[model samples]
Target chain A: MKKILKFIKYMMTYSLLILLAVFFTFPFLWILSTSFKGPENLFTWPPQFIPEHPTLENYVNVFKRIPMARYFLNTVIITSLGVVFQVFFASLAAYPLARLRWKGRDLVFKLILLPLLIPMQGALIVNFITIVRFGLYNTYIAVVLPSAVSVFGIFLMRQHYLSVPPEIEDAARIDGCNEFQVFWKITFPLVRPAAMALAIFAFTAHWNSFLWPLIVLRDETRYPLQVGLAQLNSVFEANFRSVAAALVLTMVPILIFFYFTQRYFIEGYKGAVIK
Target chain B: MLSRKAQVYLIAFSFLIAPLTLLAIFTYYPIIRGVVLSFTDYNMMLGKAKWVGFRNYIELFKDEEFYVALKNILRYLIVVPFIQFFSILLAVLVNKRLPGIRFFRTLFYVPVITGAVVVSITWRWIFHIDGILNGLLLHMGLIKEPIAWLSDPRYALCAAMFVTFWRGLGYYMVIYLAGLQNIPSELYEAARIDGASSRQIFIRITLPLLKPTILFCFLISTLAALKIFEEVFLLTQGGAETTTMMYLIYDYAFNRYEFGTSAALSVVFSGILLMFTVINFKFFRAGSEGR
Candidate 1:
């Protein structure tokens, strides 16, 4: 009787898990099915889980209707530039704030974190004007420049840097290493996993960023995938299959990227929130 | 040769120069400039500003859409408690050492990872007049007529809030899961040995332990709801009485080219956000002290 009860409880748990899983993923699955469905009726009485006649025609049509490849290239360029700048600037900026004992260090750090308390939503317009004034409008740099030095990135990196022991750095200094060498050879290497976590965070953020790219990029060819997909959404409003295919194309790369680096995401959040 | 003190200063300066300059230009300058711009008539073509004190603020106070946007955003906060409650439950469910748990976690997070544009567009299709939701409801005899979910003012904001709630679940679930993992298993073990029920364990141990994570999520989700834009922009185009403050700001500056008015709206919106943040901090402090 105890064994039967255990089996019943096990079945209940699995059933609940499966039910919730379907609830979360059914939309994407429906879109996937829709993308593959050939010219058949989409709004059936019971709804079709599987396509009756699957085809690659919608995928082909998405490419033809929009410059999907160019958008992907733009997104790649923008995302890489953003990721590099965010990680590089964050890693460098955090070093002084964390490792160095200098005048006004605490003051500087507090000032940096002040924006988190008082967010400047007005930056949306002012930054646009700044971008245009600097002749960066319609360029990829315009999209990446304003957000290049993230305050949260600096904070995250600094938290990681502070956890590095001072003895290692002192030993390097005693061995006749200069401050730069101590940072380069001893301290920087110690915090590489933190840097990796920051980079992964930066990657996802830049990959999905939309509104700024939309405001800054004027030329159609300069549009990132998010902006491009949004435009495709409007253009293909009635054409569900084409829109579904375009969305799939846009989502697959990020989804695959997440699948591999998901561990960093969880670990990164753990470090960030648990502190 | 420089002394060690000088060398340290030089290193710090060199490391900070680029990031600091960028921050000053992008972050700090904007705060001051945005306020200044709010009082002036900004000309994009001429690249000039003419001071017109109180006019922009006066016009903003007179706008009906502004209040609608404000009301919609406050109404959007209804999703926060639902998201937090469900996500904590989800975290507990998946926290178990079950088979295929990793797959389920990934599946749940698919909506969040896919980004807002994809998620919004997918839902836009699903919320269409003849969409799957309507068809399913009709087949189940839930409704006699196919309701225009996105076009009708009554249902449009609700639909947008639903998408936000759905996409947000997995994101917060992951965070809550991390919070749950931080709780030592010994507490659960101790409770079990005392013959405590699962409900008692959760209420006494889990709820109190997850306080910090809960507070953090509340602060962020509240702010996110206030600044909501993409879903409204994509789904209803801010029609059907669904305009949010962020969308209003975007539309004013970008579409209408009313830079001064947009700046005014932004200032007001920031003030609202700052007020909420202060309230949250106060609540957090009070909760911690009471504990």
Candidate 2:
């Protein structure tokens, strides 16, 4: 009797879970279906959950209509540079604050965390002025530089570093390894998981960063994937199929990256939030 | 080689220099400049900054749009708890040790990484008068005529809020899942030994243990809601009743070229955000302690 009851409960839970999953995933599936559907297949009275006649013409039009390749390259450059520099600098900054015992370290860490309260969005006006004043207007660096040093990255690394045992560092130091050697050879390697997590976070963030890029870049040639796709809405005002195709095109790389790194992503997300 | 103490400081400062310098130039300096710019009539095109003593503030106080934007943000607080409930529910449902759960997790998380632009565009299509939402509703006999989800003033803000809720639900689910995992299994076993029902255990153990995570979710979600701009820009274009504080600031600075007014508006906006942060911290802390 108890086994039957347990089985019933399990079935009920699984059904609910499956229902919610479908609801959550239906939009992406819709885009996928819409992107492949022929022009006639769209705008039916009741939308087809699956495309009756699939074609690649929408995707072909997407590449032909917009500078898809350049936008991809631009996004790659910004996301790669953004991830590398953000992780490198954040790890470096987290070291002293996390591992070493220094005077005013706590105060300095507190100062760095002060930006958490002030929304960076609110400071857009000043940042816009600052960027223009520096003569970096309409450049990729203008979009990438402000975000290259993330307080969240620093905070994440520091938390990871705090979990490292200190005796290992002491052992490295006693073996005549200098502080840099200890960090480079021992401490840094131990925190690779945290760094990997931070890298994923930084990569997806920079890849999808739109608002700052939207404001900072005026030159159409320099726009990243999101901004370029946003501009396509105006250029392809009535062509929802092609716009859907372009959306899928821009989304594929990030989704692929997420698929491969989702383990680290979830673990990293858990670490950051739970801590 | 330098003395050990000197070497320590050097290594520390070297690591700290690049990020600190960048933060100072981009973050701290801009913050100070934002405050200073709020006090002056600084036009970006005119390149002239004149001291205007609280004139911007006086005008802002009398501005109807500012009040409306503030109220919109206050009302948008509905998303915070709405997301929290859904996130926790999803997290609990998926927290089980079951087969094929990873696929579900990944599926749920897809919307989060879809980026704001994609989310806005996808939802814009869905909410169109002839879009899937209306088409589905009409088929279900919920309404006779197609509804303008994005254009109608009554539904515009609600539509934008729904988009936010949809995009954020998955992201916050991951957060709560982490919190759920941290609750040791021994508690559940002990409760079961005491002949506790599942509902009783959930209320007596899960909710109490999940307080901190709930607080964190509330903080981040509230902050995100308060700074909502991308959705407004993409979906409604800040039309009708959808203007938010962030959108208003963007309009004042970029559209009108009123940098001083934008700066002043930002300062006021930042003040409200700061107050909320403090209040949230206090209330959550008090709630936790009382528990």
Best by lDDT: 1
Candidate 1, pairs of clashing residues: none
Off by over 4 Å in 1: none
Q: For model 2, how does the per-residue alpha-carbon lDDT over B1-291 read when each residue is reduced to its tens digit?
A: 888777777888988999999999888987888888888899676667999989888878888999889999998999999999999999998888999888888888888988889989999999988899998999999999999999999999999999899989999998898899888999999999999999999999999998898998899899889989989989988897899999999898888888888889999999888888998899787978977
Each prediction's DockQ?
Answer: 0.87, 0.67
Worst 10 residues of 1 chain B by lDDT: B282-291
lDDT of 2: 0.88
lDDT of 1 by residue, A1-275 (tens): 99999999999999999999999999999999999999999999788978999999999999888999999999999999999999889888999999999898999999988888897899999999999999999999999999999899899889989999999999998999987788888887988887887787788888889999999998899999999988985677689999999988998898998899888888878877877
Write the residue-wise lDDT of candidate 2 on A28-79 in tens digits: 7788889998867476777897787889999999988999988999889888
Q: What TM-score does candidate 2 reach?
A: 0.96
